[model samples]
Target: MNLETFTLFNFWSSPLLATTAEAESSSLILAGVLLSLAVIYLASKAGGELCARINLPPVLGELVFGVMVGVSVLHLLMFAEAGEDGSHSLIMNLLQATSPMGSTTFSHVFEAQSEVLSVLAEIGVVVLLFEIGLESDLKELLKVGIQSTVVAVIGVITPFVLGTTGLMLLFGTPAIPAIFAGAALTATSIGITAKVLAEMQRLNTREGQIIVGAAVIDDVLGIIVLAVVAGLARDGQVVVSDVVYLVISAAAFFIGAIWIGRLLNPLFVQLVNHMRTRGQVLLSALFFALILSYISATIHLEAILGAFAAGLVLAETEKREELQRQVAPVADVLMPVFFVIVGARTDISVLNPFVPENREGLIMASFLIVVAIVGKVLTGLGVFGQPGINRLAIGVGMVPRGEVGLVFAAIGAATGALSDALNAAIIVMVILTTFLAPPLLRWAFSLSEESATTDPASLSGNISEPVLVESERLQSELVKPEIQ
Candidate 1:
């Protein structure tokens, strides 16, 4: 064949070759993601079962196991945001071991798989918040006498002030790092708290309601504070209009979602009730959550907030019990993924004192940990005029830093606002605070068993009959699996 004819023939063949490579690459990515999920599910179940046998929260076990298999050790499921590529993940290595793929091709697969997993993790958390919302008593939270609001306000202000001032004064740290770390302290992980409360059958308790409500409110405030600090870090000064916009938008979105959802609930019920299709209630609720979640994300708020608002709105309807039943199985599948991811992303090697560079971060961490704990613990004192309430329980309930703190730390690191030492300190603080809160909460309530254990038959008026019934249902459901 002549040169022109030969070149055209090769060009036609090249497209087919490229298509085959693309399909193969896609398959590799899918395989990596599947293997990563297998690791996550296995780790979560094994950890959860062990914890259940040992009287600890199953989520904590999931977290611990996640840490073990994560960057700190097994390196099976680390994230790309943490600056690791395919070589860092054992899962990728295993896939390569099996398939004998080229290094470049496998690296691409690992990165793409990580991105997919990250998105799945985000959806998992959204499902978790939605589930918590379904279980919470929005009416009770409203009538809980403003304690949640007060605690949330105090929870934010106290930690920000204490952590910032303490970091600056004690360690002589610079303003940006100090402020970032301080803002990090304001985070209260509702995901972790809600899981513990549900496990303890305390979701309907006064303290549990107060903690859940405060955590939700704190989540809104945390986003605002993160924005403000992020602005101040990037620019020399905070933009008043920007902060005002965030505050106004957050308030409006949350309130507006609930109000509008209530107006639409009758129509929602009718639509679902009329559907003869399977998964009617579950799918409808998820659709509502995802739409609100999208709106919330567009407004620069957390998608979890919208999912929560969706849950709160639906919880007020007659179909709540049915919805809860349908959502439970789905939750059982997705919720552990969130917990596992949070744990997996955590790098505990920062806390190791044997390293010379870690000494400075360790000292700084000691200070931040104290501030993180004390600042949140002081939120209990804000429980004004309520006699016989376990203020310690209320305060301790807000202590865990969890994923929210990690977000602040990650942002600060990304913006170059936090130094290596400060970032390490923040990581350590998040890790320890998350580890302590569940046990501390259990202990705080344990001291005053008079309210529980003995079971006062007349906890009426303040707690609605529906709440009590829900609480009893949760307790019973803990032991027995429902049969179809």
Candidate 2:
């Protein structure tokens, strides 16, 4: 039949089909998508309200909102217990009709949702990290001194030992498994610490600098440990050759990435300098991030490390603030998708299975949680230069295991090292860390600030005081207002 005849014939045959087809039409789906967007936006606002009331980060609220719309929760909320299995519910019918045929398969649906969530979550993570990098001041970090390095080292060692011992004792897994699990717990989510410091107005303080510096070190240390763990897992034994290869390869990759970034940054800025339009500068920064990410991934490192390195390089440029401003909004909208997806992948159903039947899982999860928190907290003591420094606060600041921990566990799962229970435990750790860090860090910083205020000696006055003098001299010489 011709187009007009087809429409006319089917027009009234099934009102439901007709309506669905109409809804399936671009206009209808557009409306539905728009509605979804509205719901998500409202959800975000609701999250903000909950955050305000509970003294949690509003972003956490946004995360919870996403979970509500996720397949697990509210998606299931639409059905009565009886109708759930009958497949007669409106929402289910609509979802089935809208969902691709093959997508109805549980695995396929999961994979599709997973890919989408990963992308969104990554966007959130990238932007979040970018913001952290943007706010970082190298001079501030330097002023914090050997103390920060010491703190990160101590932090790394404590967690590594505790996690390894716990895994070995509790699970009696292979040596490699124990090593991988321990390595997973070693990295501190410095992003958490940085956010906390900023919230407490301590970002510019000496303690803040030490925490930030230690965080960077923690990243580097985490990667090194990850590489070692990965080598052991893959080789089944700590091969001397493999160890040397990984160490050399990682060392070379980082040094080379930095050298390359140094060279590329100037070239990129020059390209920006020659661009005809203002947006080109922003484009150049983005292009650099993409390139760096690709290069890092090519060498078997995290793309994030590359992205971070790119940001660090651009951080040195005069347009750092402008670059950050351009990147922030895009990152903000997309990054939380990563966190929400992380939550979604958790499969809380797994927890139900193990809870009463397998107390071992709960025991293991609790042990890991303690190791995770204690390892990073103890790292704070590494802030050694100043006597009576609030090392406890700094350590607590570094406690969350949001992204990096996930990366480690994911790699283990991918490689067949981590079993389902172990993987689930890791997910619990991630969720717990993400949930706990904001409030704990806030309290830690508040205590530090209170102490600093009460006693001038408690303030990071020694280093900061000198830096202010240098800043003034540079400001006077390097900047001049117009004589308008």
Tell me, by lDDT, which candidate is best. 1
lDDT of 1 by residue, 1-484 (tens): 9999999999999999889888998988898888888899999999999988987778888999988888888999978777887687888878787877886787678779989988988898899889889998888978773989999999999989998998889889898889989999999999898889988888888888899899989998999999989988888688899889989999999999999999999999999989999999889999999999999999998999999899999999999999999988888888878888888999988888999999999999998899889999999998877777889988888999898999999999988899999999999999999988877887888876866545555455446888888999998887576631
Clashes of each: 0, 7
Q: In order, what lDDT does every prediction score?
A: 0.89, 0.66
Against the true structure, candidate 1 has what lDDT? Answer: 0.89
* Model 2 Cα lDDT, one tens digit per residue, 355-470: 66345555677888898898888777555558867777788877887667877888988888886667777767776776688778777767866876877564667768889999
The TM-score of predicted model 2 comes to 0.74
In angstroms, give how far residue 188 of model 1 lies from its true place: 1.2
In the predicted model 1, the residue pairs found to clash are: none
